[model samples]
Target: MDESSRRRFLALAGGGGLVAALGCRASGARSELVKPLPDALFIRHGAHNAETRLESLSPGQLVTPNDRFYVRNHGPTPRLSAAGWRLEIHGDAVARPVSLTYDELVTLPSRTITRYLECAGNGRAFFAELLGFAADGDPWRDGAYGVATWTGVPLARLLGLAGLRDGAAWVMPVGLDGDGYARPLPLAKAMMEDTILAYRMNGGPLPMDHGFPARVVVPGWIGAASVKWVGALEVSTREPMVPANTEDYVLLGADYPRPPPVLTTQVIRSAVCMPWPGLLPAGRRTIYGLAWSPFGAIARVEVSLDGGHNFTRVARLIGDDLPVAGTWWQLELEAPPGELSITPRAVDEHGHTQPPLSQQRLNDKGYLFAAPVPHPIRFV
Candidate 1:
């Protein structure tokens, strides 16, 4: 970040600027939003955030359409032309600092990845609503995540071009959004071939709301790790201490360490594809949902139509079963109809399954709530 960027960031940091810059819980969110968030597909959180409506999910839909993808913006979406965009590589750890134009980046080498990007606070609201734990941040239901195919140049290739120094440990990709939004990534993770500076999404030029010219897509990690509208990759020997890692995304709770652990890979989470507090006719019906884990592929999905009393395994896993890519599962049940509670639990290949409500603990920000939440529906 340059002096002008530093000054702008400082200004945003002072006087309750953190909430605004981060798009945390706030009023008048629509006033600050820049994208056309249609009500049919999304539930707007604030100016810089819009979650996909899980009810809109259809059977066999493997990829989240570009327009329907959830948005998690640190600041308003930036409108940068590919012709004018340049990705700068610099810092003490970089031996040969260089700036590459949009055209130059795409021409090198490229690969496409089908991965799921989820916010650290994707199910934040569940803590209070389901677990009775008070927490802060957006009240994201289970819809703050989506899977998409991202096409881009590998970060490692770019780092190789820049020539890294011996002690290079952290790679912080800075965004072009206000105050240069960014987060520090470990050198090891940055070197992974899956980590890419994506320029295209779902087979089309990245939308302006989604970082237009380019963005970093860090699969399996918290969405914050994948900064959008990326403008610079600042390499460093020491860990970079920005608001994102230090204060915002860090886990805060009495159960956690004094400093709070910096959130990383997403947890095993599952969600039903029906409306929250939905309705269904009294008869035989099939229940459908999606489940995923950063740890490994989902091994099994169990559904409890009668709440937590008993769980029945889904008929089969559907679509792609890629670990970080997520998979869909469905089951049939005879409905006697009245008021019904449907709970879904997923077990990953590592044997990690969603915890029951009895085992859930409170976290300050309501992050990573992976307990089995019962979806309520009325049969008419």
Candidate 2:
């Protein structure tokens, strides 16, 4: 919280009526708050200090520009009154106790998914390989991740409008930028499938730093349990009460202090959002990247040019996958003409392969680097 207290909290949440959450539709959003000019955005400052947000235009575009989308503020950026928002459900298998506002939770019955909002420290600066390029959190050279189209209200219809009596198991979600954070999920990930409570993004009404009147869209876990300015939701069986939502995504052992409990199922990752530093330009070329996996989809994205040694396979998934267990991939590759430095790497079909950035500095914990993107082409 520097830079003039984050520009006076985005000028007090941009004149107190913020709403323009990207992708997934609604309408009308305009309130220019602190866009400290870097071509406008990629994910600007907050959490290890922002400003890695780039690509304001052509980079093979595909939705990521609701004010250059990518502002993940875990604290400081709360300014409500979407006609006074509210959302609550009681404690333990709620058979009673329900509340909703913000246009009655967006007039219920809504679901629009096009997920991919990464930032488990998206490429944590390749875990600072001691600054040979890539260093811990928000040196964020890789565009802090994007891809939206989220719309809301679904978490199984607001947990079936608070009617689940029979030993609830976990679902704690309390946020309004709470200084101590809270996130808990289980009860089968809040009754699984398309978990959303989002208001509307990329179509309108929601952009108070990407979580306007409300937020939560846990599609494919690990985004700090998808909590952002959300009001409250604790219909517990006693569990997700937060401790960094069960110890900072537990899966430790990169030589640390207390780690391990990160159950497998999300490793193969990739990124190269239209040649930012992946630099390219030489004879009929085409290369795009964005891949994911909490375990599923993204079964191929291997581009190597004398770095990770050898490999080539790109199919971008214009078909097959998404049988509903969440695992994303969106690729496009084309290269041929001498002098290169390419490295994209990705593979998931339960095979999970995408690691390098000095191999996460030898076991500190899955920073999950999908290195091989250092393209420097120029053959004119």
Candidate 3:
């Protein structure tokens, strides 16, 4: 990395720790200290918060560097020692409940996979900006997503050791943070080959903020499903309904009379990584960004300089085209010196296309805003 990049990386990693320390001092003996904002790598949403700036993600970058990876914590980041951590597997449907210490879990067969974890509320700001329909929750742009290589044991392997009794259905993973946050996964998803109990991230021990001892990794699903600081797994015969599932993560709108459907696999979406209100030199330039689909890989991406009125197919794709997750795409184009509106639309292998903001469904919680993102630029 160059000087500028290295500086940004350090600011993101080290600055956060400094802010955290200060926040703890200010709170003074409180169990939960607010997260401090970092000067680089992200924009602050709260005291214990940072979201990646879309422009920081360059074209063709595969694994999101751990320092630059975004942080999404529901509560304060817990300070837990790995040596004393244990993951308990129990509940109504397991024949033999088991508690595996951190060391014991790491000794099991391990597998690694590259997957992207996106907050379901990604692109929320677009609802108010583009469609004039504001909703509640974090007004995230497109930076609340990142792809990483996670190494750990398949969740199913651990479930097998616990021995699921007949009629076992849902798998609830609970975190170790404040008051404990938990989410449930269907038995099928929990047993999928890709789902894992990740202990290492990017070939290193998982970062404390990201889940130190262990966490569940449900590839291609909303980040909430892969609970961080996971300490227990409750294998149950009935669907698990916790606050994370019933009160949040489910869609609610005028169109639905009853409780809306829960958000599972993320919708197809794309974003341009250029600076907001960017100034670009006239003539030829290449535009770059990422496109992802929880159902499958992005099959095609189209770019439009004049908003969404007309689109030209992307000239090339720059990263691994993993059929089950996210990929980066780039386009080369010529522009005259003037104001320009750039938009990119993506279609996944599953035939899901990025919808226009006007046609998007409004949810009470402002989740899954997957429209073709509009980025403004000035050609100097």
Candidate 4:
């Protein structure tokens, strides 16, 4: 929250490192969710059909390899064809129904941006502190988040094409991704700046599991809002268009308390993406980590080499310029004078920050506790 602190965390190649769907009900099967490629990958803790990717990198590299980006799916991956897909916008709320074939949508308009996509449950297992119930879903570790360059058309433009009616207050996005499950976006967010309907990632067409033909990328929001393998968009006047769409990833019960009596802005958070235990140099060296904010541009990133006992500010670039989709700030620490102690902290423009995980009370879903998540690294 300090106006003076402006950097987050980082270690290096030698340092350490690091969904929901509720709609299957209240509606009949409207269409089929395309099946993913037979050979697609996933993370399953070496069992339960989960597959994982190991990422190690050099200095100054920020992009997580496309093939290695983490995957979080509620059901099986849906396979969609680029050549045969079309996006339709229609519903009682809309002034007029409109449809766009793949070619038509692309030719109308386009844009591109680089940002991080993180599953809301990126580090659920650590919450094992509560009742010993293993976290569900991918049982994800720190690697469940990744950054990439996404290219596509703006969702706002698409809404304009639909020529929305007065009753059209929101858009319920249903994907060819799963049967009958659709995510709803309030009209404002759906038409906001930078909200994208993407078909490409990192200069290439999206991978099969990532919505091969098309997907919605609502940067800085939880992954649920960015549905993949999209099939249809239904404009609506309803508040809870889909129960699953409204059931967001939330930290329930009392082990964790909602902030300011309202849990909306995601606190700044970071993790070290390099240096496995086997390769630690075993000496004095700097540590690395990444920090981010869902509220706005991260203006201050801090580090505590000794738990939360003390914090030091780090310096970064390409930040404070403006708030962009997937607002993130990168930082590095000097690793201290000797055997450095370290963990990164993120503080956004709104002044919210990450809490220490060790200090957080346990919760049922075990999420967004805002507790600081520290990644440890040693300098050999």
RMSD of each: 4.7, 18.1, 8.4, 11.8
Q: Report the C-alpha lDDT of model 2 over 16-110, residue by residue, as the tens digit.
A: 33232211123323223323335344444543234434334344354566666556565545556677557776675789878777788887778
lDDT of 1 by residue, 95-199 (tens): 998888888998988989999999989888888887677799899998889999999999999999999999999999987766677899999999999999999
C-alpha lDDT values of all predictions: 0.82, 0.58, 0.80, 0.58
* CA error at residue 16 for candidate 1, angstroms: 28
Error of 3 at 20 (Å): 15
TM-score each candidate.
Answer: 0.91, 0.34, 0.90, 0.75
Q: How close is candidate 2 to the true structure, as a TM-score?
A: 0.34
Deviation in Å, model 1, residue 288 alpha carbon: 1.5
Q: Which regions in candidate 2 have their CA more than 4 angstroms from the true location?
A: 1-37, 40-79, 88-97, 100-161, 165-190, 193-207, 221-269, 272-292, 296-303, 306-338, 352-380
The true-structure Cα RMSD of candidate 4 reads: 11.8
lDDT by residue for model 3 over 1-380, one digit each (tens)?
A: 22353244333322333345436645765434233335557876775556787677666876787887878888777666676577878888999989887789999999999988888888888888888888897888888888889999999999999999999999988776654678999999999999999999998989877887788889878888989878788899998767777788888889765666887888888888876778999999988888888888888888877788777656477878775557888888788999988899988887889887668998878888888877998999
CA deviation > 4 Å runs, candidate 1: 1-35
Task: For model 1, name the residue pairs that clash.
Answer: none
- lDDT of the structure predicted as candidate 2: 0.58
Q: What are the clashing pairs of model 3?
A: 35-47, 35-48, 297-323
